[model samples]
Target chain A: MPHDDHDHPHALLPPEPALRVKALETILTRKGLIDPAALDEIIDTYQNKIGPQNGARVVAKAWADPEFKDSLLNDATSVVAELGYYGRQGEHMVVVENTPGQHNMVVCTLCSCYPWPLLGIPPGWYKSDAYRARAVREPRKVLAEFGVTLPAETSVRVWDSTAEVRYLVLPMQPKGSEGFSEEELAALVTRDSMIGTGLPKVPS
Target chain B: MTRVHDMGGRFGDGPVNPESEDAPVFAEDWHARALAVTLAAGSLGQWNIDISRHARERLSPKDYTRFSYYEKWISALADLLVQSGVLTEEDLRGEADGGEHALANRALKAEAVAGVLASGGPADRPSNVPVEFEIGQEVVTARPAANRLVDGGHTRLPIYAAGARGRILMVHGTHVLPDSSAHRLGEAPEPLYAVAFPASELWANPEHPQDEVVLDLWQSYLEPE
Candidate 1:
């Protein structure tokens, strides 16, 4: 009841979907189909523990160390498992690199099949109708909406995850970041950058 | 079987409104709860991932386009539970089952949740069968008659890519075939390839002629061009 004390509008009535979810949870829990504690753990695991930060570390290491990058580009599943970022939607891994002449973006047109272990749950836009329908057909236009503009000569490669293997775009390291530490580079890796919707932030 | 979920190159959909990079993983509390419950139910091993996906895809076109993402998930989860005999409509309405149903090896406990998730389901399987296609081979996707295949059960073959010619980019090892797997037929591990289809092949006037759409397709979905 105390959680209802909010200043914002729509605070009084829980949305329709919310009530439906609550009812379903109650029914399942009552029927011994699911555990309440396990539910808490699942939420906590994705909500806090597993997220884009794990992927940022992977991207940062790839940029900081060429050897690791080679291994990552070659055998992403084995190398990322070494870093303890493996499981679920990321059972099979493929790291696509972005060069000056080429860019790689990822989408699952059939469904929202994302690399949950590496990048956590996909953003709302990644799962929306527009993204699923348009990303494969007109990736450049979709990228522009995400504030990314590639040159005319820079060919865009849109990866539609129609199968098990998941894709992570390794954005090209920004110029002037030659001497930056891995930690600094990780900070520059945004979730969208890895998803190929936007570029990694340049060192400030 | 070519439902709304197979929408790839259909036109007139609006802009992709991506959220800020730091948006919360779950926009609302119920969304998190819904996802967690669906996943927890999934731990029972009553159905495979492909089966669960097919459940969602099985949504009628009207309901498929109408419901939100989690809404579809929870709705499908309910259907799965009923179909699996894990729950009943009477129980869903809060009526007592009188402890009649026997459920064992079903509880995905709090302690095991982390380990279960970390040791996630792996779809890859060793295959004695020879791979049919190789990288750089010219291939064309299956042009399903009447937009359905595999007895119209469940398929990962999107409609747009069907009949489009492409060159194999990379060959992923044998992986679970969703078409048969979704129907509880068998894993039927098959060689999967990341085929690179030029935008021109899949669309009328693609925004960029040089652009390519690379899709990871199973062997059955493709044939020699």
Candidate 2:
């Protein structure tokens, strides 16, 4: 076949180039094709970098200091402001305190809306359509995957941030951190902890 | 129709539930991308610009594509600079003289000194450094923030936050915005504690019972609260 005029570099294929490529891969898979490891590597790189890592510092501070705790419970951004950090586009932040009985999970519902300054880039899953869609609908099912089995009696508030404010989950601090310093407490505050799907418990 | 991102249920939630990221994994090949970048960089002025414009016009139609936002910014800037008289191929490609790298550090340094100047700080202040604020200390969110908070006319507090009442939650030492950079390159000003807020305070919500939100509203955005 003769070379066509469309040979210019930097020319992008029509939209959904990624989707089209995946479709091709799917066809190949149905016919017993490519190894899945190729896909795994792709997911690994972005997934790790998506969000912030604040070990339960915010929660720990809240747990320890009655005043600061009140500030955090009242307003997370202001509490963060108390520490001197601020939000990006998703400014106005809310720290949703999760009790043993009630669990709260936040999704922007608008876009994969996020609190980037506090949390950093959201994990790949946070942005995925699946998380956005189902987190709103099946909060219990999704939380279960994260090893969070909630009591049926508890109120599950799934916040859908619209324009002004964004929500961050303040996970319950670990049991042994009674004497930990603020920095130590902060270390336990992962961005995931604030997101509510994950607990502040450190992995063994 | 609202964008799938808009999420107000214009169309039904559909088969692609928001929670479904398990399968149909995305494509992310760095080698392929690096190759694509090198090749695209090789492409000339109008062609790349046209391509970029077309892509932007169509919202970068390619899916499963992996280009970091910063990567694209640099590529587009480099392309435009090379294409225009601002830079030449000879400028990018230099004869190595008494150095390991082709470009000189002095030449790079000189680029930053190229243009623009406004003020060192706001009128009457020598350095636009911030006055340290204690937690819960009362302060008014500056009327415009530009006049009160910023020593220079540069600021980061959103236009919306001007004159909002808040207290000093923390004192973030002096930091500089690009506005400060372009204007006061040497003068980094004091960063103030931004007050976060409750959404209920800003918006009315019966569904949200006393549901408060927080904002790291800059010191500029707060008045004495």
Best by lDDT: 1
TM-score of chain B of 1: 0.94
Q: Compared with the real two-chain complex, what DockQ does model 1 have?
A: 0.41
The digit string of per-residue lDDT tens for model 1 on A117-144 reads: 9999998999999999999999988988
Give the Å error, residue B33, model 1.
Answer: 0.4
Q: What is the number of backbone collisions in each predicted candidate, taken in the order shown? A: 0, 46
For residue B106, model 1's alpha carbon misses the true position, in angstroms, by 1.9
The lDDT of model 1 is: 0.84
Cα lDDT of model 2 by residue, A1-204, tens digit = 011232212232212334423333332223222223333432342244323543245566786787887778776755675554453323456677777666677765434457654564455567545565556555566677666776656656666553235667777768887877877777766555578776675623
Docking class of 1: acceptable
Model 1 chain A, poorest ten-residue lDDT window? A1-10
CAPRI-wise, candidate 2 is: incorrect
Give chain A TM for each model in order. Answer: 0.91, 0.69
